[model samples]
Target: MTPSPILDLAGLTLEVNHLGRGVRFYSQVLGLELRRHDEAAGVAEFTVNPHQTLTLWQPITRQANDERLAPLRPRGASHLHYAWQIDPAQLEPSKALLDAHGLEWQEINLGTDDRPDPTLYFFDPFGHGLELRGVNRDDARQPHFPPTPVQRPAHALPVMGLREVALAFGDYAAMKERLPRAYGFAYAKEQEDRDFAQFTLGPQAEPDGNGTPRRWLYAWDPQVGLADMLGGDHALVRFYADVDAVAGQVDAAGLLSVRDEQGLAVRDPEGHVFEFVPA
Candidate 1:
């Protein structure tokens, strides 16, 4: 197999129906530092982990053609799902924090039979499903990636980093053929049946060992997400990869692509928007 130039999943964008409520939930409730907020454009950015971001943009229907985000305005995916890695030491504490905020959540093990990764499932105010998977700091795929600096009660649910973004595909075959071809992701070590497949990317630190990649794009059945339709018109996933090479692969595969100063953007058969920028 050829090497995938995907350095990392730089950011994931989710559409928020209400910018104020979304901002409050992420900043006040989740404790993520509000790095930037463009009130005019209704866009907010939150810092995640050592080098990642969680962006919420409430697209302005009338002025959706803003130059900065033209063609693909800041609109994000709805009812889409993603996961954040958190310190296992704070599992119960995370649950308690959710309770304190009156946020209902459920726990499930999302690991192998031998390895158990306790995960908490919950929803943000905009109905975006989120997960707080219990993880050890050392379990970071990249050892250089250290444990997150804790901040006691204020930042109780310290998210180690963004781990996975799950999407429901109306047509899995086309995605399986194009995603890896354009971005160079590979099938996971094992299969969770045939209908669902996860493409792994970034830092293969222990590819030959039990270590898992930090970036995961899960393509699964439609029943998991409500907004899942034949085309995913609401989400945008961007990555730090070899944009030129990715663009080449994308074109070679006969997929439609649009390039700009920042990077390349492409829409898949499912209406999923993906952007590739220089790493």
Candidate 2:
């Protein structure tokens, strides 16, 4: 069998309706450095992790041309959910920052059999779900990747690295089986429920000394009233991977669904769109 490609979780690109508001919240409120802002192109880039980045692009209606070689289809404001990792000690200070800015947030406890890591969930100005999770050094549920160097704005708690990304799915078995077969993600942890189930994915390693592996979630039977965030017009999550290689395997597995200028787009059994673009 052809093994899944050595897929490295690069970063994410967000298509936001309000570029100015999104940029301000991510840079000033989230404390990430604004790497670049191109008013003419209507796009902005922010360095979220050392190797990972988050690109914010204005609504397609205003786009004359974009730096990205390919035109992103079905692109507009995104209702995406992504998480960032933070040192445990930085949690209180993070609260202080959010409180000072008057940003509202709620807590989530993703408990495992052993223990639970503290998590704070909030939304960006455009209602994209964002999370700050306390890094648990002892938790096996997390991945250990090399620390990404972030330029911390003065007086703001340091944002460490990308933690986890959650994707909602209707056909759990296909996503569970196909992702590992196509990407080099090894199944790590799982929680099963008749109505809700979760699977974690990452590169298998013996503590590479980097820190933790980037974590991803494939969730099935999403909670009621959250379908918009899962599989709506603006619902999408993109990953940086070797598109050609992935396409090759997808063809081999008879899973190749769509090929476009943007990259190889595949629809999971549940009809969720996942794009793999050139790294």
lDDT of 2 at 111: 53
Off by over 4 Å in 1: 72-74, 112-114, 143-147, 150-156, 189-194, 203-213, 225-233
- Top TM-score prediction, candidate number: 1
lDDT scores of the candidates, listed in order: 0.69, 0.59
Per-residue lDDT of 147 in model 2? 48
Worst 10 residues of 2 by lDDT: 205-214
Query: What C-alpha lDDT does candidate 2 achieve relative to the native structure?
Result: 0.59
- lDDT score for candidate 1 against the true structure: 0.69
Give lDDT tens digits, candidate 2, residues 1-279.
Answer: 333343444556576777788788888876777898877677788877655667787765545334342333434325567677777677777887888778887765555546655567777777677777766555554443444436687555577767655555555566667667654445554544343333343335223112233455435445432323342233334555667777877777775356777776665444444566665
Give me the displacement of residue 118 in model 1, in angstroms. Answer: 1.1
In terms of TM-score, how similar is model 1 to the real structure?
0.85
Query: Candidate 1 on 1-279: residue-level lDDT in tens?
Result: 566766667778888888888888888667877888887887888887646788887878687523644665435887778877676777788887888888888887666679776678888887778877654545556532333654534644666677678777777777677677765766664355556666665534223123243567777756544222222245788877878778888888776667889888876667677887776
- Look at candidate 1 and tell me the lDDT of residue 142: 51
Clashing pairs in 1: 76-234, 77-234, 77-235
